[model samples]
Target: MENDGSAIALEAHELTKIYRMGAVEVHALRGVDVEFSEGELIVLLGPSGSGKSTLLNILGGLDTPTGGTVTFRGQLLRMDSERALNLYRRDHVGFVFQFYNLIPSLTARENVSLVTEIARNPMSPDEALSIVGLGDRIDHFPAQLSGGEQQRVAIARAIAKRPDLLLCDEPTGALDSKTGVLVLEAILKINRELGTTTALITHNAVIAEIANRVLYFADGRIVETRQNAVQRAPGELAW
Candidate 1:
């Protein structure tokens, strides 16, 4: 509801994605059109097969659309070129998934260091971990952390690159409500402090209160979009 004209972070026009299996065609996205403003926090709610994941993949350059166009900062995404997509993903996007894909042997700092080492401009692993409220736990390995802390480590890894866009696919899916809220607080902090455009997908509608806007997806399309005039903190959400 509130757009301060910070510039458009991402735009998708009539985007469609189709998957084929034998004679069956699964339409993942149906000409979806959406925009994510810079520094905005948007939440996506949907059932399974609702196409939110497909949209996220396309936006992050992890997948291409079957038709239409998607762009970042007004630059058309060369979805057809793997090299271009790779560069775009590496330089601009950050992703956090349901699972914490941290290396078992690496400490939290070391896990975050993986991305900072390769990024063009990145914050130190210590700073990244601090942003996620894990500074004191930097010496702990993945095996020593709890589910939510591990997820924060994953978030630290993603944002250490100072990515302009953050795409989260069920980042709290594995944790309980309390733990999930902690993870969300970390996300909220990043979006606010870093001015990162964020898009989050989740099945739990309660989490929607924490977003600036909410998009409901059904049958491969966004059926409703709602704006939160006053955003709620993650701690305020019970489920």
Candidate 2:
């Protein structure tokens, strides 16, 4: 699908997710509505259980919502089947999470190559690693790399497919402040340089300063949305 000049990358309307446990139904998302523009970086901030991760998963096609709709480039998401969702995810989305999820036995280059091999059109493993500042360590195994480096490799593996959207869920949750900053910097760089529509879930409010837009979630809803007049670089953020 061709995006119009205004270029809305993704849209979600009245999104709701519920989990059933015996007789209890727990609401994870309740009537959430949001939009992500092309090349824009968004930060989702909220306390635990506020639905930030739930929204991200829905947007990434990893989870189906109980109600409402989601669209990408004006195409309605086929959430009715896992096969369709998996195809959508493979074609359009990349994901990063708190855990690196790297294969311990594979070299960093090999790890990234795994995704590129299946992608319709993908960059070389070295090229993807280079974007995240791991050009020199592409051959290093995950076991030999630091936590920060492993995370960067994960980022590289995600983006190597040249996905249109990148969804990150607490990607820096496992790192120290200094190392977290590096990971954030890599994400910022990817969004800016690759023109990837990026949405990141972070508990650190300070990290919101690095985004084009900030969304605050509470009680399974987006309580507030703010446009950052002046976006800060990842290095400029206090945490």
Candidate 3:
């Protein structure tokens, strides 16, 4: 279950994805081989329609690959049943998408509590919010909060489950530069404090500087990878 210092927390071997549109087939991913490790933050970068999102979706169990193997924690992810995949996502993975997805009517605390209620071993909503530096905003409704605050609540909700893996697809896409930096700070804090293995999908090259490793995608394949000697803080990143 442990990578033991190996940068292989999650791995895909010859992974591929194909979509059938009538008689025509679209290949979204063309045999990608990659490995991500524990206690590291990784940024998946690519242009629009480059399959970065497709790959992130597959890794997060939102989509299935059509070919090859996916292994997480030494267990085969590709062959998992729906029930198993659901359990995997619930018990081990935390996901944050671009949209906040917070309930319009629910206060931030209530929104976060919804997940902790279902989680097997969860941090209290208060604890999660505090970690995201939103301890004072718990009583605020999404509509009453700023876009960044709502997104922070969304993040608190995801991490409240005490998940081992965090998958973010364009988490900062909806925020302005300053707000995005705040969101990224919370993500970085979680990565540093919990040692969670995290993978982020982003179009911004600046975000890559915050990652222990960066993977650049092009035409459904990884075209490059860069390893940082040390990840920089969100404040240190340049657009």
Candidate 4:
């Protein structure tokens, strides 16, 4: 459903996640409320164990909240049904994790093709690669490419399905500063060109400058929220 103030692509209300380890309980999230506006790029920033990843997982349907509701396009997420959640994730969400999970034996094109084959409405593998600036490297195997190039291939695979939401958890975490910036550029390019609602989780605060809004997480809660007057290009960031 749309937010009163803006178009809400997705949102979580009164979210909480608690893990039980015998008698001890750990709260990964605590009564959080957040919304992702359509076509906006929002970043979550916090130290380790601050629940940024937890929140991302919940939003992406990889994990369920202990007490809360996640909604997409005004429909409530079915946390109780694995089948529904799987379909939702398969059809609507694109995820890029810190590591490039490309199959070592597959060329970039083939790697991306795996997703397109299953997607109901997918772009060509080559087209996805082109969007990430990897058009020329489509036939290269992961080992034949640099780390940054491989990461871009991973990103291309994620976007090939033409998902409405792109949830990235440290898409640049394994790269050096220059390479990380390249990955960020690819992500921003998708958001700008395709109008994907994107959310990124990063430990580096400099990355926040590239987002329309930033959520500062601490101890299982969003402690501060900042909205940028102007989004800086990823190439302009250094960390």
Per-model TM-score versus the true fold: 0.98, 0.97, 0.95, 0.97
Report lDDT (Cα) of residue 47, candidate 4.
97
Alpha-carbon lDDT, every model? 0.94, 0.93, 0.89, 0.94
Off by over 4 Å in 1: 1-4
Each model's backbone clash number: 0, 0, 1, 1
What candidate 2 gets wrong by more than 4 Å, as runs, is 1-5
Model 1, 67-155: lDDT tens digits are 98998998999988999999999999999999999999889999999999899999999999999999899999999999999999999
Error of 3 at 126 (Å): 0.4
Taking the tens digit of each residue's C-alpha lDDT, what string does model 4 give over 40-79? 9999999999999999999999999999999999999999
- Lowest lDDT sum, 10 consecutive residues, model 2, at 1-10
Which tens-of-lDDT digit does each residue in 79-155 have in candidate 2?
99899899889988999999999999999999999999999999999999999999999889998999999999999
* Residue 50 shift from truth in candidate 3, angstroms: 0.9
Model 2 pairs in collision: none
